[model samples]
Target: MSSDLSLQQIAESVTKSVLNATDKDLEGFQKIIDETIKVRESHRNLQRMIKSYSTTMIQRS
Candidate 1:
């Protein structure tokens, strides 16, 4: 009976550890995703500026 209790305790500890590690990993992934979105938005804005400048130059020419 004691052995069974020890086994149950070990299983619960391992489960908690695994859950915590997974949560940390998910947080890291979310941060990466957020940064990627920001970078992509900046790139798009830069492209729009370039396009506008090119159009203006063509009209001036």
Candidate 2:
């Protein structure tokens, strides 16, 4: 399922989960890290889009 949560908020939740997790739960923690990377990548993509849009608008004006 998809979520409306922000990357920073999800990252913080994952961080807290990892801190309290046991050594046997490392695999799940790794999954959380992978998801966090995806979130960050998505944020980067959004930033790029905004920058491109702003540049195009400036050139038009």
Candidate 3:
């Protein structure tokens, strides 16, 4: 399986878990939320890095 597919699967599972969680599951839900935020932040940073690198390459040509 590709990394993208795996990540998508993991995200789906987390979403379902959060939706079905009870009050007792608050800690689990919090962990999921935190992980999601970290993933989003990482993704944004990666995009910015790639954009900067690509822009530099274009300018160097």
lDDT (CA) for every model shown? 0.82, 0.89, 0.87
Give each model's clash number.
0, 0, 0
1 against 2, candidate with superior TM-score:
1
User: How do all models score by TM-score?
Assistant: 0.63, 0.60, 0.62
RMSD per model, one decimal = 16.7, 5.6, 4.3
Q: Which of the numbered candidates is closest to the native, going by highest TM-score? A: 1
**lDDT at residue 18 of model 2 (Cα atoms):** 76
Clashing pairs in 2: none
Instruction: List the candidate numbers ranked by lDDT, top first.
Output: 2, 3, 1
lDDT digits (tens) for residues 1-61 of candidate 3? 5456676787887787778879779787788789999999999999999999999999999
Candidate 3 stretches with Cα past 4 Å from truth are 1-24
Better of 1 and 2 by lDDT: 2
Q: Tens-digit lDDT track for model 2 on 3-56? A: 698979878888877788898798877787799899999999999999999999
Look at candidate 1 and tell me the lDDT of residue 19. 68
**Positional deviation of 55 in candidate 2, in angstroms?**
0.3
